[model samples]
Target: MRRLRIEGYVIVSADGRLANVDNLMPDELKFEGDKKFFSAALDQADLILHGRNSYEDQPSSPKRNRIILTRKVGTIAPDPSNPKATLWNPAGASFEAACDHAGIGSGTVAVIGGPGVFGMFMDRYDTFWLSLAPRVRLPDGEPCFPGVPARSPQDVLAAHGLKPGEVQMLDPEEDISVTPFRRAAS
Candidate 1:
């Protein structure tokens, strides 16, 4: 029941890790082609949602409209660091209300990563773009989603009612492929 559409985007390792144990995305996993696709997708979104740690702190981030998921806030608060960002607690306010408070009415919301933020939108994602680096392996690393390393990322998505579409190779030399999973129709 959100009025606005939600799409999740993430790139995982062969073993289904989003980042290494230290919560740092390894350089080996970054591919130019995959980055291009991810960037383009976010560029089209009306709003971007992600947790505090996931914020890149890039110079351009302040200009991008975003919601920073956090428990420190009781409900909704303007992010002190970024003029266009809002600190939101999902438990305190509904997604729509949060968007309304942020001045974004109806449009695509790109939900970016870090496990907790990604897992919170499991049942709500209209589409989840999963790009995998098949040759990269990071054992005992942070999972891309909940139940990941123990259970495959595909299993988690299927359980949440999302089905994968055709895989497109983003980088053949890097052996990276991206799959867009859509929620099944009722």
Candidate 2:
């Protein structure tokens, strides 16, 4: 749409949860291998996009350019807390415009998530890395994407035209594996 390659990164529990009942990711769901893979992938992104509540604090966060989805902003505004961050409302402006405003002409855009954020870009992702923590389960917890359980993360991605790639096992003992779902070629 704007000469951009959009990709998503998320870790879900056995029941398709991104977080616990309290809307926070529990420590049990965190794994070292998934962390390393996610970090490396994020390092290569030209821009990072996520919802207001979905930030994962990392050492490179301050320096990384980010477009934060927020309902507080009428259009696009500078994020006072972070110089590298911009607050954007999709209701007020288009994604292409928001990217342009953020000085992101084109490159890889890493869409980190919360369910609401993930749902917004359903039809636009070029690839989405889905890391699964098979041993963990967050029953009645926050879903990885909207309509999860009823519609799995895989089903959601598939509906958005992305087909699953080969699954890569990140941790054998913990049964953690990641799948890169690429958009099916039209």
Q: Which candidate is the best by lDDT?
A: 2
Report the C-alpha lDDT of model 1 over 1-186, residue by residue, as the tens digit: 446889998999989998887888889788988988888787788899998889544445567899989999999999887788889998899877789878998889999888888999999999999999998998888999998877889899989999999999999888899999999867
**lDDT of each model, Cα atoms only?**
0.88, 0.91
Report residue 166 deviation for candidate 1 (angstroms). 1.0
TM-score of 1: 0.94
- On residues 32-84, what C-alpha lDDT tens digit does candidate 2 reach at each position? 99988888888899999999988868787788899999999999999999888
**Residue 21 error, candidate 1, Å:** 1.2
Whole-model lDDT, model 1: 0.88
Top-TM-score structure, candidate number: 2
Which residue pairs overlap in candidate 1's backbone?
Answer: none
Off by over 4 Å in 2: none
Candidate 1 regions off by >4 Å?
A: 56-60
For candidate 1, give the lDDT of residue 36. 81
